[model samples]
Target: MLFVAGSTVLGGASARAAEQADETSTAESSPIIVTASPLPVRLDELAAPVLRLDREDIEASQASTLGALLADQPGLSESSFAAGASRPIIRGMDNNRVRVQENGIGAGGVSALSEDHGVPIDPLSATSVEVVRGPATLRYGSEAIGGVVNVLNDRIPSARPSGGYSVSGGTSFDTVDQGKEAHGALNVATGNIVWHADGFRRETSDYDTPQGEQFNSWTDTSGVSGGGSVLFGNGYAGANVVHYDSEYGIPAPEDPADPVHIDMRQTKVQLRGAFAFDSWLRGIDFAGGYGDYRHDEITQSGVVGSTFKNKEWEGRAEFQHGAVGPFAGAFGVQYRDRDLSAAGEGGELLAPNTTRAVAGFLYEEMSLTDALSLQMAGRVEHVKVEGTALDTATITEYDVSRDFTPLSASAGLVWNLDGGWVTSATFQAAQRAPEAPELFSKGPHEATETFEIGDASLNEETAYSAELSARREGRGYSFAASLFHVSFDDFIYKALTGETCDDDYASCTDAGGTGTELDQVRYAQQDARFYGFELEGKVALLRTDTATYGVTGQADYVRAKLDGGTNVPRIPPMRIGAGVYLEADRFMAKAGFLHAFRQNKLGPNETETGEYTDVSMAFRYTLPEQMTGGASVKISVVGQNLLDADIRNHVSFKKNDVLLPGRNFRLVASVDF
Candidate 1:
């Protein structure tokens, strides 16, 4: 039997809905810039659901990592592997299914391979973020079968400066780990040329948890970016270079006395261009990037135990066209190449690998009537994977190559109702080829503390997903809600074989345990089902000449199970929250309570997690120009887990040993000139 709750207004395009006015309001429901879709239409014009986190919300959150900043949002959860390493889990799907990209390019990091690794992209580097679901995945690729989290970086200038020159900077501090960060950006536009530069540095000490302290959870990171663009009469072209470095530690439950840490570096170069024409073809846009990344895992003795490296490049081109015979659409092509390798201890897990892929996608929309539209899209990808396949049976490695052609398609319907109300339904059938790690891994991984194994005979994974959502954009009251379900065939996942093993694979099944510290897990496939719903909205309770008071609330739930009546491991439990806010000219504040219910649904060898409530607060004030030498300045105070709750992330691999950070007070001050 299946269970689903009923709600009339549970989900919608929140980005297109009303602003809460927590830190003041948007320019009266300003149109959001949408990028996930092939067409440059408003949120309502797209069939899938989109949730955006704007600049104001980032300032209020004052979170350093991308996962920490967006974890509390509806339909989203974090792995919370450590204070420094965390990744978002969308509707119980994570890792390979979710694509975390910067300006349409992959992060080019190894974070997706393991939860203990950090996503190199920082929250401070992005001006906004979009969490897109449903048909939007067709535009990215098969890897985005779950969804796409697109980070809009400020490294490249999209528009000219306000007054020929502009500068902005900010500094933040938090008490949880005594974290401190400073960031600055400068943009100058003269004539048709625009230049941009930005840099940031962040450092944190081991964070305090409800239980004394998390011994090895701290992070030190810095990055710098510079770019320039030449504006044409109809479009613009730009290029940017970014360099990043970071060192972070994870929980050491396996070896608490001698914790392991990682040091990583990445350099990326990107080029983007857009052209508008006066023909049936409306415009052409292009994006390309090259990234060289590497990381070293160091033991407590300060010796590098393993090294991972990746050099990759990707490029995409899009062609937009106007209506033709009652239909309008866009078509595009994309190409990606990656070369990755592991050495030292990591070499036992996987050998050198290379992957190349090319895909072509197109989407078309037809207006059935004035208030209704039909959208359809399709994509076909050709992928070639080359690597050394490990034969667990023969205890030998052999070079192997495989090729696959995965296809995907989607269809959606949008209905426009009266009074700023809109609803949409989208369905997609997508397939994903086996990633390098899934098909070639073997041996013990000290970072995750798992003796992993893989099979080279794995096939493509496929899923059929659907979403239904509605939204209302209003000043006094607004709301959005969504219901989604995804069914998978041949779902590839890592599961323990109810056994333990040592560092050597031969001992894994020898009836005796050598390194009993490591759990034995293998890559396998199974039929699975997932379904979830999300609800979020805000309503004005009181309105006065000086300020407006509003009440806000949100709730989300997801459930997944295998065909054999077994629960899915690491699935987030139901969460419900509510809050109140005040918005004025110079002052704004919000207080909220978010609670996670107890989770009892257990997978094999999985433990239960207790319930917890998080009390949070945010306040912001704008200073007068006279006080800051004509520079616009804003100060914000943000608090998280104010009640100091003892919380464990159900989605985390280390949930049994690690606790979420306790009470935290964050202060942010930014200035613009």
Candidate 2:
């Protein structure tokens, strides 16, 4: 059975009839909804490729960060320099080019400003996650030109439970880091009223590597959320509140004698509503949120060295429409306002700034034939930033204001061929304004150990891209492949200036820098291009009445370069992997081997990374029923990097100074009541 929101395509007529019945009965028995999209569209019908991580997937991975959760996916890699802080690199693009969201709303954090800052969302508390690479740029913003990662927690009660109440809980432990995690969720409904509550906590010691333990690699995370809603005849409305807090160490090279840590906290409130209609418009959906986030960098002496804060409010509204002469789609409006500031020792890196943005978008899909369809989306936005910059040395202050109008559009065509084969082609053009850090930063960043300078004259970056994908799904075999290329005009990047500076911005004359050996870097613009290919397939080897076995293989590679012949920095190496799996009524197991090819294509002042391979295995077993509603307890064991080989992520800035985690093992258990 193929399960998707709005539409479910099953293998047989009986299966189709069963799905229809479930859709009308309870949401738990129905297909998962695609909340990331403006209009409710089936996953398979989407013009662009999407990667989804369900609750089961998240539980099995035992990932500590969003970057680690997606690092293994094709065309994706983790910054991986530090265990406590890392961001996803999509299709060779990272930083501001990628957008992180919680339930389709901006994270309202400063993770994009620097590599050491961690994303505030807690993956352990999420119900599902969705990744989109193309069309998301139109609906969300130009920052999604690289991709979008939407974490769906369902904090706001969207629907009522079939019964009076439902409860779920899980716990896990990892050997590599001596880590422990636990989470629980509850949902109760009475008549037209529904309520929800969830909480999660995680703690870990410094992780162990093949050589020894990585210093300052510990993490502590916790979060709680509560919400309630009223179900009206027309639709449902709800509001939610969430609190998240985390404190983690920032591992440093052997050179640094003192240790660093980050203390962070966030409080967020969200309101959502949806209404069904009987007119040309199908329904209206709206969501709005406000967030207050703050973080402090602590030194070994127990003093707070630097502090950062972000206060933001964001909202979106969209109206779904029925088919009208082969046209069906949704139009929406979005607004966001953020005030960001920094203080203390490292405050000079970025001036306090406030940004405001307003946008309108339209998306439409037309069915040209039984097997052919076209999708197009466009967005226009106005953005403004206000700040004040002061020259401390000269005791002079200056007013800073910048404004931009960014536009983005995308078109795609999907053709359903015979024999369950499908193909899609997409082209997109997107523009993104320079972020505050890229436009105004003027001092040292202690976390990244870099002396940074920004360019106020930088213009908005623009990208044009095209992609072609093909897939064939069968009963015993399946395969997918895609090729993509992108060209950028005025790509903004940090370039090394071949100058070194101490923490006080004083010239460092010693070869072995004592205070801080940080190179000076300046934001610059250049014409660049990136291209990649990804392929994945699975084939069944044996099948029986109650058991089946299969083999899977996947490979992906990306290349990037500038127009003037310099290679892009920190590009992920090419990777190929294979795995085998067996499934039965009560047990399931899988094993895999992954190889990362050596990367010799070096950027200016960059070093090459050696190749490495990893071995991983996992298995799960369902015990006898122990709860109501056919809910059975399940236990899972997972192993990663079983080889214990030394590994380095080519995309990581600290690859040469630090090694990736060694062999790891995890035991997880979950139950529903």
Candidate 3:
């Protein structure tokens, strides 16, 4: 099955490649704007593969969350435990391996620690989004070793009164649930001060699955943001604050006898400010932010209550100047203080503690030529962890404190080859320290029911990666491809030893005993590597003054191997997707299909999941301009398990019963006033 699905995806990719080649033979030049840089540069001048999602694309997709929207991109996958909980997986790395940024600053808090937690930002209010793939993301930080997803919003007040408001309502056929959302913003300029304010609210009811109606898991979210800026001579300064809150849950099984239920709620607040200073020596940019996040969960049986809280503060300052001889660059120092604590209903601390990180970085981008550019960056960070641990047997407490200093660096070169083609290559060395839960937690994970044991002596994980990419943009057509290989030293993974405890409750701690425990699954410095390539392009087959038709397709393949003759776990197989789109003056339509090949090659702790295909279609219509109103209606139908194939995302952990939302349908209506 795996071989057959793989061949089908490859065949489809070949056909698309051929079509792209033909389109490029007689294409015209299309001007592509580049915003991946601090200053906007043309696409032809960039050496990296940056994927942009504009407002039009965002509206067309009509996804509820950023994670779901990114799932359409090549080389990206998402896993969700419920409608409100989803996380992105790039290449084969996720969690702490990936970074999610808001504007240009790190989205501080605890979203990176678990898969069930949802990102706080609302995508409906975003103006645009960009994904920096591969090692090129090293400029952000070592935490982005996998990649970077940056969400951009117009939180800054404009110099003129310019703003819009939107409201939407939708429902799903399977869940019989209703959803409503509203957002409003106003920006006005007066004298030297520009003021801006925005607010949004969303609410949804519990949804239904194939088995039965999932209950008690409704979502309610609300946020308000405001900012003010003042222009002083050649510099400007601004301050902004945003507060958000959400509550949701996951229902137990259909049978009332199951006796289990899970509920979660989160609240977040962020305050930030930036100041720009014009000086004779160099221009300086200073920014600082503070964030507070709290998560509370309630479970029906084994674990009555579980709660986690995280509070963080960060500050950074950078200076850049282009007049310096081949030395136009930015250097900044950053400090983050994080406090995390978790406990169960019995007052026993499951994971306790506080950690502090101080980091400094230097980044330089030099133009060797009009067609060639070089980038060099490095960061040094010191992390300190302090906590108290309880010894189960002795019933005694132990005080622990440890500090680690990790260093990371990267270099890259981009070249604009003649003939509308561009290429870039990058190499990076990165490291990640252990998270709080990984070092001090003990007991069963309420979500998975696995007994977790922490190792205080764990060391940092490190890796090196290299990537090469090329892109071509022509009239009515564009194409891009990237290849990457990453090698890891002391990669941390989780494994289950085929042993059971004497009472089947606690795992044996002695070396000679037979028991199962989830610890930093240990392994010597083993060599592991990941290689993948992605190709995506679009071509306009026919175009007229009032109408256009186009076809787009993308495919990605990834393979991972370990030196000890083992297959890497949790790696997604090859995937391919294609879509056809047609647009008129006021009407648009699109149909697309995505196929994921079966993955049967099992690692020591993995199992096989069958192949699956999903199909979706959408249509939209715009009202006439004379009415002084704009409204759109969209309907989408998705078919999962098109082949009625059974699949599972995880062998031991998640039995995700791949029911494919089973012929689900949704309709949404939006209006602007």
Q: Which predicted model would earn the best TM-score? A: 1
Off by over 4 Å in 3: 1-35, 56-64, 134-136, 156-159, 163-177, 206-218, 231-235, 251-282, 300-304, 345-349, 388-397, 498-527, 629-653, 657-660, 671-673
Give lDDT for model 2: 0.79
lDDT of 2 at 338: 90
Q: Which parts of model 1 are misplaced by more than 4 Å?
A: 1-34, 510-513
Go through the candidates in order and give the C-alpha RMSD of each one to the true structure. 4.8, 4.2, 8.0
Candidate 1 lDDT over residue span 146-264, tens digit each: 88887876566655666666788788899999999988888787777778899999999988887778888888989999998776666677899999898889785577777888898
Tally clashing residue pairs in candidate 2. Answer: 0
When 1 and 3 are scored with lDDT, the better candidate is 1
TM-score attained by model 2:
0.93
Better of 2 and 3 by TM-score: 2
lDDT of each: 0.80, 0.79, 0.58
Ranked by TM-score, the better of candidates 1 and 2 is 1
lDDT string, candidate 3, 1-673, tens digits: 1100110010001112112222211110111211244322455544456666654455444345666667657777665544455566788777667777766566665666555567766566565666775433554666677888777655653222323222333333322345565565555556666666777676766654455445554567677777866644444557778776766554333233433333333333333333333443344555567777666665445455566677777676655445467765566677778777766621233456888888787766778898888877788888998876546455355777878887888888889888988888888888877666556555544443344445566688788888898887788877788898999886665544443333222344443446543222322234678889988877799999998899878889888777776877777778888878777887777666777888876667566777766666666666675653543444433322233333334322344432323333444444433
After TM-score superposition, the amount by which residue 508's alpha carbon in candidate 2 deviates from its true location, in angstroms, is 7.6
